[model samples]
Target: MNFSAPSGEVVADRLSDFGIWEAEYRQTLQQFVQEVIQQAETDLEQEPAPSRPTDVDLQALLDDLRAEIAATRFALQQYRQSLSD
Candidate 1:
């Protein structure tokens, strides 16, 4: 065991831990993205289809709203996780 620098075994352990964290973080992000897409589709379906509203870009608005909700939910989840961590 080298006191001045960490041994290869310690470095390897740290790398493994980082890999696990990265995998978990990626999974969470992927789930959030899918949820956002699904929510946008739901919102579009629930929106009222007006006959005279030709200028209303529903898809664009829905996309924006979906992104906003996803970001908010992601941050909230991260905050909650941080508290536990």
Candidate 2:
């Protein structure tokens, strides 16, 4: 019954089942792949372009950063002194 000739259609039935399984598997895989591709494309499109350094004032930015650092250091020193007291 399970011969190569499919004496009682046994082998033939198995072949049919295999075919159906392959079709479903292929379709599901394709759908998953397409969804990932679409989402990646959408993310890329929504993201903004990066800023160029030439477009900004380097000196002004450096000054601002230095001021912020000084302020933070002062705050930290004040807090530590308060804790010691």
Candidate 3:
């Protein structure tokens, strides 16, 4: 009877053939995730801050409200004139 265990070099070569590719794939995936996270963080940092309500905005809203009130009053006057006529 003659039997011998595989040599260390043979086992190492077989492991490298599969293990190297798996390791490369895992490394690539990890790098991709890291890049995506970094990009998201950078985008969040670059985003503009929310604007606070300013005096100009309030003035513009007030002007719009006044215009609407004037228009409504004018329309009511025209409607009343038409009813009288």
Candidate 4:
């Protein structure tokens, strides 16, 4: 027994199924969006403030260069200390 129709009944049923699927799909999308927003907020909460250069601020490209120099100095001092010991 094969039943098929080009009538409004089949169209209505197909549209109802599509409506249900769209609602569920929308809910899933909303959840993912909310999760991303919350994760971003949490990450921002944990992040340190960015050091911006101002008139009073010592922050510069030179600061990073100085840090590297200080690290190398410390390492060299440690090597010299180890050799002396």
What are the lDDT scores of the predictions, listed in order? Answer: 0.97, 0.93, 0.95, 0.93
lDDT of 1 by residue, 59-82 (tens): 999999999999999999999999
- How badly does each model clash, as a count of residue pairs? 0, 0, 0, 0
**Per-residue C-alpha lDDT of model 3 across residues 1-85, encoded as one tens digit per residue:** 8889999999999999889999999999999999999999999899998897655687788999999999999999999999999
Cα lDDT tens digits for candidate 2, 4-75 = 654668878888999999999999999999999999999999999897667788889999999999999999
Q: Top model by lDDT, which number?
A: 1
**Relative to the unseen true structure, what is the C-alpha lDDT of residue 67 in candidate 1, on a scale of 0 to 100?**
100
User: How many Å off is the CA of 47 in candidate 1?
Assistant: 0.6
Residue 45 shift from truth in candidate 3, angstroms: 0.4
lDDT of 4: 0.93
Q: After superposition, how far is residue 36 of candidate 1 from its true place, in Å?
A: 1.2
Model 2 collision count = 0
**TM-scores of the models, in the order given:** 0.56, 0.58, 0.44, 0.54
- In model 4, the clashing pairs are none
Better of 1 and 4 by TM-score: 1
| The candidate that achieves the highest TM-score relative to the unseen native structure | 2
CA RMSD (A), model 3: 10.7
Model 2: weakest 10-residue lDDT segment is 1-10
